[model samples]
Target: MSRLVVVSNRVSLPDEHGSPPPGGMAIALSAALQRRHGLWMGWSGKVKAGEDPSGPISRREARGISYALTDLSQTDLDDYYYGFANRVLWPVFHCRVDLAEYSEARMSGYQRVNRLFAKLLQPLISDDDVIWVHDYHLIPLAKELRNLGCGNKIGFFLHIPWPAADILFTVPHYDDLLRGLSCYDLVGFHTDDDLSNFAECLRRQGLPDPITNGVCQAYGRVFRCGVFPIGIDTAEFERLAEQAARSETLQEPSQRIPGCKVAIGVDRLDYSKGIEKRIVAFDRFLRSNDHRIGKTQLLQITPKSRTEIPAYLAMQKDVAERVGRVDGELGTIDWMPVHYINRSVGPSELAGLYRMARVGLVTPLRDGMNLVAKEYVAAQDPQNPGVLVLSRFAGAARELGGAILVNPYDPEAMARAIEEALDMQLDERIDRWRAMIGRLREYNVYRWCDDFLLGLDQR
Candidate 1:
């Protein structure tokens, strides 16, 4: 078997001594690495002074998996990661062009980092290795590898939305990015919508059209592209929920509120998450229907992300004020309408809360795939499951059609959907949940990884 080489911006090194790994890509990629005797390579998540970006990779071995890590300088973190990747690419991909800050220095830094990665990775490559690059941070990496005379079949996957041609064209050097993307043997997106957007962007630039079979000829190269929506480890999440239900952590919420029905939202503190909109919808639900004010509660646990970024800092304040206003207007001495938690909780505790909640509000303005929606579904009680109020813009909404879909931009619509979810009958909830679970069981994270790898290996 050819070694599978996985590269990303940040590698999540698993804990030693046989403890279970973290969730999402960490767990999925670790399984793949162990199976294929692969090497995981990326930044070490440490900022050091005067460290060479293209220096020799420091290696660590854990649980039969080898990790090749390199440290980044503070300037690289600021210009490449914070400036180009987060400030420019992230917002543009999510269709928030207003937040994108494009500059020549930022683009140069991004290119320098890609060049550095390729230089460091060149010596690690064997003739039979197949490389897989992940996310927006490394779109140009495959091209850089090719420039270094590496012949391995390299695939790239984008884990975010792809904006339309006009929105995408707003970024400087958009053509260069597209040309870099064409260098990959295969490119993957989370949904057909994103794939179509990519195709349309190429067309608007007078590039050749992509066929229905997912082949496109651009920049004098032919590449395959496909949709591979990500999924959670459903079985693992279910087991965690079962264990969490019997733990003391769940007892805290019950003891605090006794019998209040809970609605939950878990996301990072980001402008694109529509956190404030969700809170306003919940507030609307409380104001319009006064009968359910004390009967229900909303617990939004958002761990802060990218706090150094101005947009994130502003969003945190905006969400906090919204939560405060809702509580002030609707709080009784015994009950508060919203419990906004800014810190992250343990996975087991989160599972317990998911099990406890009557409705899971995963209403993001835009997302690649909202894993929390699937996690909520997986954590629900089999006999009496909670309803999932999902945003139509989320990639998961395409697959989890059984969820109560709402437009995140419309607070009234979201409030109505939340009310519907809350008022849904048990039998209907079970039917919806069973349908979603059936899909999840058939197409979990293992399947996604396998499918992408299989596609990458094909001619």
Candidate 2:
């Protein structure tokens, strides 16, 4: 078996045993590296002045996995990361074309950084290694690697939605990006809808469709594509939740209002998360059910991200104003209808919060796969599970069909779904939870990694 070479935009350094991993990519890739003794490589999230683009990569080892990291020059960090990747690709991929920012400098910087990655990474890789690149930031990496004469079986996985051809073409140098994808031996998406959109994009360009068996021919090269929906380590999550449930820190928040049931939403402070819409819907829910104003509270924990970005700054103001409006309209001397926290909470605390809540609200305008939904489900008590009110546009909705699905675009619909979730029967909650848990247990993160690797191997 070939050693797995995992590459992503950010690499999570291995931490202490029994501590929850930082991100889903961290958990999944760490497990793969531990099982196969592979190398993980990525940017070190550092920007240095006058740093050589071809400098030697930094190496570290911890928790049975090896890491190779490189720092970006300040200019590259600005143009490549904050500029093109986040401003352009992130918005376009998530179907937010209105927010997409384009410039020649950013495009050139993106290509330069990818070429730099290829140069630095080439020395560390062997011909027998299986290379797996992750996310929109590194879409052109496989092409750069192939240009350097590394013929390893490379795979690419996009963690966000892949836009239709019409939307994708809106990006500058779109042909180059598509051509870079053709360099990969395999490509993976989170859901069938994403996979279909990708294939349709290719078809629009006169390329062959990705077959059910995951093989396609484009740019005179064979490419394999498949839906590899990511999952969590269910047993591990449950253990964390159990440990959290025992903590007083986790108990105090829910006990803030005696008899009040908590409905929770955890998301990054981003527009695509539908944070504003969620607030509006919660307000509408309160308006219609005046009797439940003090009886129920919507707790939205949205940690700030990319604060330097203009759009994110504006959204922060928007979310704050809306939360204030709702609270002003529905608050009493002793009780507030909504509790909005703009800071991050640790996993253990989050698990505790998840267990304490009576309803889990995951209503993203559009998402690849919102892992919060899965984590929420895993934290629920089997005897009295919390209902999941999910967005139909989320990739997780495809598998989590048992959830109370709603269109996030419509506040009234979302409000109705929240009401339905709140009024759901215990037996129905258990049945829905059991169905979701069955899928979670059957298709754990380990299994997703295995299946993708297996697909790449057979190709």
Candidate 3:
């Protein structure tokens, strides 16, 4: 087997700073690197002047993983990550044209950072190593690698929604960006919608005309682009859920449930998550469908993220007000229609909460792949499983077809879906849950990594 070289804007692996091994994306890749020896390259999230390491830099080691991180100055961080990638490209990719800040300064920073990745990466490359780049922060990286004469199978995966061509055009220099992307051996997206956007971008840019029109294409330039929807480590998540049940963090909530059927909503505190809308729906559900208010409970655990960004702060305030309104209107001492928590709990504690929930309400307005849905499925009891009420717009909805899909924008519809999901026949619920769980367990993160590498090998 060939060696693997994993690169991303931020290394997901653990460091001396005491961050837990990231539960999903980072942990999955770390497992792959451990199973098959390789080099993981990314930023150390630090800045120091004039001390650049120019080799296969190794930053730390733990549990069969060699963690490597390079330093970036404030200028590099501002231009590449904060300015271009997040402010410019990220918003455009995610269909937030209204927020995209396109300027030469940001674009220049984008290219400079990508070039830096390539320069640092050049020393690490060997004849047999397959280069795998992750997320939108490094779309131009493969092109940079190619410029450095790296012909090894290089793969890049985008972890955000790929906007429609009409929307993607909102970016100033998309033509150059798409062309740079085409240099990879394989490009991966989380859903058909995303792959469709990328393919349309290819056609619009006048890439070679030997094209079959569709949501996905077998080749981009000399590379293949695809939809490899990532999945959770089912067994690991199940274990986490079980452990969480015993965790002290969950003890209060578990005791408070008082045997009512729990509806779980776990998401990051992001505007696109439709968190506020979900609160309104929960309130409506309590108001109109009074019969279940005492029998059913809603627990929304949204861990805070991007707290420094203005948009994020606004979202937090919005969520807080909506949550308070729901509780104030519907609470009767023993039952609160909405319970909003802004924090992160370890995996074991999370798993316990997941297992207790009868209806997993995962209604993100748009998401690359909502791992919480997958985690909920993985945590359900095989004998008496739970229902997943997911959003039709979420990328995971494409793969988890058995979930009771709802239009997130419609509060009434989502509320009704919640009712239906709660009242679902046990045998049918078990059947759907079993099928979803089987799919999840089979296409776990290890398999996702393996499939991308296999495709890269073909290059």
Q: Rate the local accuracy (lDDT) of all candidates.
A: 0.90, 0.88, 0.80
Worst 10 residues of 3 by lDDT: 210-219
lDDT of 1 by residue, 1-459 (tens): 789999999988876674436786788888888888889999999887675454458998887778999988888888899999999999999999999999999999999999999999999989899999999999999989999998899999899998899999999999989999999989999999999999999998886555458888988888899999999999989999999888886857956876788899999899889999999999988887777879899999999999989999989898999889889988989999999899988888899999989999999999999899999999999999999999999999999978999999999999888889889999999999999999998899989998999999994
Best by TM-score: 1
**What stretches of model 3 exceed 4 Å from their correct place?**
15-22, 49-58, 208-220, 243-252, 257-259
Candidate of highest lDDT: 1
lDDT of 3 by residue, 347-422 (tens): 7777888887889999987788888889999988778888999998788898887799999899999888888988
* Model 1 lowest lDDT segment of ten: 47-56
lDDT of 1: 0.90
Q: Is candidate 1 or candidate 3 better by lDDT?
A: 1
Q: How much does candidate 1 score in TM-score? A: 0.98
Model 2: per-residue lDDT, tens digit, 166-241? 8899998888888899899889999988878887877878865545567877788878888999888777788888
Q: For each candidate, C-alpha RMSD in Å?
A: 1.3, 1.6, 3.1
Q: TM-score: which is higher, 1 or 2? A: 1
